[model samples]
Structure formats: C-alpha cells, structure tokens
Target: MDQMFQIGDSILTVSLPVELDHPNSQAISQQIDEILQEQYIRGIVFDFGNTTFMDSSGIGMIMGRYKALGMRQDSIRAIRVNRRIYKILNLSGIYKVMKICRQVEE
Candidate 1:
C-alpha cells in the first residue's frame, strides 16, 4: 500500500507523487478505491505539493474520485497547488469541481 494516504474523520488525504502520469495515476486510483471500500470516506484531499507534472490520467483520477463521492463539488480538494499545477487544473476545469488551496490548513 502507498504510504501517501492519510485518513482523518471522513476525509482521505493523498500526497501525490512528483509526476502524475498514467502508471502512477492508475496505481493511486486503485489504492484509493481499496481504501474507500474498507472505510466510508466523504471527501478526498489531494496534496499536490510534490506534483510537478500531471497528464490527462491525473485529471481522470481526480474526476473518478469526485464521481465516487456522489459528485458533490465540495467533496474534493486540492492543496499545496503550485502555479504550474494550478494552470493545469484551471485549464482542465477542475477548479469548478473541487476546492483549490495554496496551502494546507493546520
């Protein structure tokens, strides 16, 4: 299992890898699915602090999770998003579906 996952209350936080390509996205999706099956998760927080690159697969992964959570816009979040990732997210229209934050709240 990937140590990137962290659970708190009903939320699942995923610390993404440096590069979010097809292989990485697929593995992350599978891991998140398994965790969801074992526990009731209402929201997902994607930590993109380390993610410098993301392909379309990453968008798909995020969208899949959003749908899995009943398509509630507030059920997904992106934290520690740098400028580059933010542009991608903006262009992908992900900002409309999930909350984006420049920093994680302590």
Candidate 2:
C-alpha cells in the first residue's frame, strides 16, 4: 500500500493501497492515529483511487477512524471511489458515518 499522508489547508488526504487488507490496514490505522494526535486536523479525506480490493479489516480501519473523528466533530470524506469499492463501502454502511465526495477538495 502506498502510505502517504498529504496535508493542505484544513484537510488531510490519505491515499490508500490497491488492496486494503489486514497487514496494510493495521499500518494505515496506526499512521492515521499518529497523524491525528500530531496535527490539527479539521477534516480527513480517504482517497481510494488505487484501491481495487478491500476486506473486513479495511472496513474496521475506516469505521475506527470515523468514530474517532466523530468525537471531535471532524468531518471525514471518501474520495475517488470506483464502483466496486463503493459497493463494498455502501454495503458496510460507511456512507451513514462519513460523507462520500465526488471530488476531494485540495
């Protein structure tokens, strides 16, 4: 997984890997947590541009982040989601927790 976190303005952008499974998801989850603790994040954008596969662990990762940010009322958005992954996210009911953006703000 490409593990890169980009921050601009009030948003933090995280580009996920092509396959968001257990190992990578764990790393990502930890990284995101570290970033949240270190930065003043107003919003989070999870970019699934290169992601082609995701599993239950990925769902857990997303949900965990969503709930953590929710406590602070920090907004979260999913971006660049293709149809297949979008279906997974939809089935997991993540849209109810976070906004799904058509285009992510830079």
lDDT agreement with native, every candidate: 0.94, 0.84
Least well predicted 10-residue stretch by lDDT in candidate 2: 97-106
RMSD of 1: 1.3
The 10-residue segment of model 1 with minimum total lDDT is: 97-106
Per-residue CA lDDT of candidate 2, range 32-61, in tens? Answer: 888889888778889998999999999999
Best by TM-score: 1
Candidate 1 structure quality by residue, lDDT tens digits, 13-90: 999999999999999999999999999999999999999999999999999999988998699999999999999999
Q: All candidates' TM-scores?
A: 0.95, 0.87
Which candidate tops lDDT?
1
Evaluated against the true structure, the overall lDDT of model 2 is 0.84
TM-score of 2: 0.87
Per-model C-alpha RMSD = 1.3, 2.7
